[model samples]
Target: MDRRKFIRNTAATSSLLTLGGLSLNSCDSPRNKHITILHTNDVHSHVDAFPNDHADFPGLGGLARRAGLVHSIRQENPNTLLFDAGDIFQGTPYFNFYGGELEFKLMSMLNYDATTIGNHDFDNGIDGLLAQMPYAKFNFLSANYDFSNTVLDGLTKPYKIYEKDGIKVGVYGLGIQLDGLVTKQLYKETVFINPFEVAIDMETKLKEVEKCDLVICLSHLGYEYNLEQKPDDLKLAKKTKHTDLIIGGHTHTFLDKPTVVTNGAGRDILVNQVGCFGVNLGRIDFYFNNETTVADGYTIKV
Candidate 1:
């Protein structure tokens, strides 16, 4: 079925998609490798759907719905990887009561592969974040934030490499500056590094040393900024080398399609972000062959 038609049909039903027998196999001699990436950003502790009478996104975007969607896709393609771009804390009443424990538990239940840290994740302060760290099953990656002097020193990694069905994917994380966004007491002793410098080093290490087939950045740097000095996904994509996809957050920008920009090496890289509050799920499919690799990304209304 056509992509738009499939989305339209799925949107008609409360169950969302009914993509039965969606073929992953093709007629080619050498079969293609398919990896499905399911992502969410700035979910902010929304465990339940919005009230049906609400102004925007009424009767949509609950963790249950998002889970079902992810489960269905994983069933179809077992090579699926789920990721979060951050701000997983401090939004709904769930966070207020449980203090981010519930959010980590649910993401663990959904088998999130990895996630980056957002400034809001520090709402409870460094010690508070460490207290809830044991609840998360997935690894936390942040290349730009230096936690050496903080309680989270060894708790998070700068990057992780995963091999799914013969394809090696190197994923790293970048957080926005915490100076103004987060209270100093909350993120005490955490050093904010230059994102551009970190991006260069991470890309070089991942692509050169690790020899990854793809390099993805889970960034909480927002999508783009009008100010030239501010580092956003757009600027990162253009300045970086050997990075493939940037899954972003912080601005809550709703991008129906991933934006492709040419990097410093004159190669096309993608930057994508779904709206905040778990309102949408981002899907990016990478098809790999011997000679080349290509990607197609789309957003699903959760």
Candidate 2:
């Protein structure tokens, strides 16, 4: 199948797509490998669904409903991974009451593999953020945030590698600059490195040295920005090579489908972000065989 056509068709429709004319279930053969990536972003402590009378996401988006959706998807495909793009902190009164403990605990229950950091996460201060770390089961990844002088020094990893069904996946993280978005006293002493440079170095190491079959960047850098000088997911995709997908957050952009951007190497890179408040879930499926790799993605309403 033509790669461009496949992406177009998948983006146009939410129906299940076949891989090389075979259904996803049939791709379980030893010669073929299927991987499913489930993601959410900027949930912002929405543990409960909106009221039925609410104007926007009425009766939609609760942690329980999201969990059920994730559970069912996991049941369908064992070779699956869940991720978030940050801003899991601040939004509702929950954060005010618990100071992010509930958010971390519930996300841990949902089995999030990893996530980046958002500026709003510092609302409770760096030390406050660190205090709730004991409740989280997943690791935080941030390559550009130099936390050597802070309590988060050894807590967050620069990147992580995962292997599933013979496919090696390398995931890194990039966060937006927190200088103006977050107060200095909140994120004290955390140095912000250049994300573009960090991305190139990380992708090089992951693709050339680590030899990962798939490279992903869990980003809180927003989807796009009007200013060319500002770094965003679209710019990051066009600037780097080897990163297969960029799951983004911070802008709360609701994309029904993944935006396929041609990377510096001229390869297709999927950049996707579901809307905030747990109203949507992003799903991407990758099929790999001896000769080629194909991908399909769409958003699921929670």
Top-lDDT candidate index = 2
TM-score of each: 0.90, 0.91
lDDT of 2 at 267: 53
> What lDDT is reached at residue 179 by model 2?
91
lDDT of 1 at 194: 95
Candidate 2: regions farther than 4 A off:
1-30
Q: Can you write out model 1's per-residue Cα lDDT over 86-165, one digit (the tens) per residue? A: 99999988898998999999999999999999999999898988999899999999999999998999999999999888
lDDT of 2: 0.86
lDDT by residue (1-302, candidate 2, tens digit) is 11232321222233244332212111222447788999999999999999999999989999999999999999999889999999999999999999999999999998989989999989999999999999999989999999999999899999999888887888999999999899999999999999999999998898888888788999999999999899999999999888888999999999988887767865567889998999999998897774445677888988
Model 1 TM-score is 0.90
lDDT of each: 0.85, 0.86
**C-alpha root-mean-square deviation, candidate 1:** 8.1
